[model samples]
Target: MGLLDSLEGMAASAMTNSGSDQAKVAGGLMQALQEHPEGVQAILNGFQNNGMAGHVEQWASGALQTATPEQVQTGLGGTGLIEATAEKAGVSPQMAQTILATVMPMVISHFAPNGQAPEQSQFSGLAGQLLQKFL
Candidate 1:
């Protein structure tokens, strides 16, 4: 299944958890990434800036890197992207942070299936593709 399908499935199952509106959360994430065409690089930069270089490399390795919610928050802290996403999705910032913590690793891994980041053009299309699939 594709990213949207996987997110939809996760959203359906996570409804019981407060602040787990899967679709909106996923949309918020895509929205954040879309708003920043350089988001993938920004995210990696954030990780490096926050002293998470190992985690950063692991993510690009197409391997799942388990990062804590607090770590995600810190990683993205400099960029108001999460707050922007929270506003866009009408969700709380904390919830947005939580959702990103859970989903960002998956996104990175999926997009870098060959264990390497895609070119700029390919990266730019990711959010649009996710949104299209979402619709």
Candidate 2:
């Protein structure tokens, strides 16, 4: 399968395996990533800047680690990602932060299947697909 197909499949699988709330958070995250000029890189940068480099490294190594809501806030706070996600998902910011603690790891794992972060170019089409599938 192609890269887009793989991303789409991963997103579809995530929605199928998760609760409705999680699906909404995932869609919201996708939308947020799409809107960000830096795309997935922004997420990586946010985590790294917030002293969550270890977590990002773990995810890039193909491990799924849980992040706390506070970690999410610290990492993504100023980026408007969390707020945008909450708005798009129709959830409170706190709820979005909680769910994103799970969804973010899954997203990183999907993009880092080979134990490395994906190129920004690779994610250019993913948000639209995820939004279509889950939103």
Cα-based TM-score, every candidate: 0.69, 0.74
Clashing pairs in 1: none
Model 2's lDDT to the true fold?
0.72
Index of the highest-lDDT prediction: 2
Worst 10 residues of 2 by lDDT: 126-135
Q: Global lDDT of each model?
A: 0.64, 0.72
Give lDDT: candidate 1, residue 22. 45
- Cα lDDT tens digits, model 1, 104-131, are 7766665555445566567535554544
Model 2, span 40-133: residue lDDT tens: 7788788888888788778777677788999899889888999988886678999999999987777776765543556756674545444454
Report the number of clashing residue pairs per model.
0, 0
Pairs of residues at least 3 apart in sequence or in different chains that clash in candidate 2: none
